[model samples]
Target: MTARAFPCALGAVLLTLALAGPGRAQTAGPSPTPDHMPKPGMSAPEMADRAAGRFPQPVRVGDLPGRFLLQPEESQPVLGRVTGLVRRDDGGADAIVRLDGVLGLTRLGLQPLAWSGVGARLVAVPVEAVALLGEYVALMGMTPERLRALPTFAPGSATAIPPGETLRIGIVRPFH
Candidate 1:
């Protein structure tokens, strides 16, 4: 794939990560482990907070093992929920999800995440029911069958997918 085939929007997601906010105060969160378990069917945001140790249950993103999830738009679960729908472009139907109802990305702290000069890079993670788009990716729509097929591993290990390491769960770019 000549880098261009990947999509401009997608390139932007990576740039945002490289520029992730210094992070608030760097709370003394739980250290990663190798025996973390799944959330037993929790929302992506819920899972993230749990992993962050904000909840009494304290869910660790690293505890998720090899799961497919991005950082939550908002740390505090509010009155809004995430929705996914399909749009027909030309003769093709594309899957789309708004990153937090439009302004979610800004809330996620991706400021000045301008596109990198431009290039192609391969991103890999072990998880199922993942729909990869140009700039962002989604995981809430996954089904049991798909979830079972994903690769889950020990938590706290480098093999684990770091929280906020994955972002743009809501699509915030034009698919061109």
Candidate 2:
């Protein structure tokens, strides 16, 4: 496929995966090997926490950019791409996500038709609400409509988080 078509194809595949539902079998091949198991010293609860992306770890602010923002749910899932980070006066961080319409089609380089009355907007999502699940950042209990309704993020008015700062973030380890 051409470079332009690749993004559309990828979006379609992701939409398909989202529609497949979490209960559906993701792979037809045999189960993964034991190499995907948790760490040797990790307790059962720790392993469970890691699987849920609740195990917090100190991570640099610079590493957060470019991660895809995902709302993982059984229903329609919302997707966005992180553009930057904002530092709040409370010493917390927020992720700037580019959301277009309900599904964030703008992130795929497609604009919603004028008749649809949808447009792209940047929203600041509290880092506390984020879960680092593998390479994707998961936001639980969020919907596209709710995300779209959030106040738009203004970089000029917000304090930007420096790349060197460290923040404690929850991470999901597929293989710990």
**TM-score for all models, in order of appearance:** 0.18, 0.58
Alpha-carbon RMSD of each model: 25.4, 17.3
lDDT of 2 by residue, 92-123 (tens): 67789876655455656786533332666778
The Cα RMSD of model 2 versus the native structure comes to: 17.3
Per-residue lDDT, model 1, residue 174, is 23
Question: How many clashing pairs per prediction, in order?
Answer: 7, 0
Score candidate 1 by TM-score against the native.
0.18
Give the Å shift of residue 16 in candidate 1: 64
lDDT of 1 by residue, 85-131 (tens): 22223321222222222233434655523233121111222222232
Question: By summed lDDT, which 10 consecutive residues of candidate 1 come out lowest?
Answer: 117-126
Worst 10 residues of 2 by lDDT: 35-44
